[model samples]
Target: MRVTEVVLSVGIGMLFAIGTFLVLRRDLVRVIFGVIVLSQATNVYLITMGGIQGVAPVVGGHGGHGETAVTDPLVQALVLTAVVIGLATTAFALVLAYRVYEEHGTIDLDRLQGVER
Candidate 1:
């Protein structure tokens, strides 16, 4: 594999690891952040899967005629859609966290568990 792919693979792994760590924490906010990180990692992985050594998938764009490679536009579109969905999900999660904090007076999952509903 190329050096760039190797580097990106390592970075993706690191992000996954960090996100997992945050997700296992007791803090509700940290869990939300972890979910966001995981989503971003997924987007990056999708883009990397589309390959990085090609021109944009535009019609009659730069590069030779029918000789140069074009990056996968489908992957780009999927990532864009994921980004918008992720934003909405994040906002919803934050609102839920806020409501939990308002009702329970704490954002810690452990503390929340002890409180009666």
Candidate 2:
């Protein structure tokens, strides 16, 4: 494996670990942030799966180039969709959290769950 691949894999792993930890926290804000982190990690994984290439995947342009690899446009499209969806999802989560805070006067999971502590 190349250095870039190793770095990207490690980064994705770290993001997942941290995101999971934060999601399990008692704070709604932290949970929201964690979801964002997880989404970003997923994006990175998708990009890596497409492989690193210097040329675009265009027919009759660079497709005939010998020994040249073209980047997959499908993966890029998927990643772009994921990013937009992630943004929308994050915004929705924030709105929900805000509403919960306003109604309950607290963002703590335990407090929201009727726990005295």
Off by over 4 Å in 2: 59-67
Clashing pairs in 2: none
Candidate 1 residues 6-109, lDDT tens each?
99999999999999999998999999999999999999999999887877677675657567788888989999999999999999999999999999899988
**lDDT for model 1:** 0.91
Residue 55 error, candidate 2, Å? 1.4
Q: Which stretches of candidate 1 lie over 4 Å from their true place?
A: 61-66, 115-117
In candidate 2 the C-alpha lDDT for residue 18 amounts to 93
* Whole-model lDDT, model 2: 0.90
Shift of residue 66 alpha carbon in model 2, Å: 1.1
TM-score of 2: 0.91
lDDT per model vs. reference? 0.91, 0.90
How far does residue 50 in candidate 2 sit from its true spot (Å)? 1.2
List the pairs of residues colliding in candidate 1. Answer: none
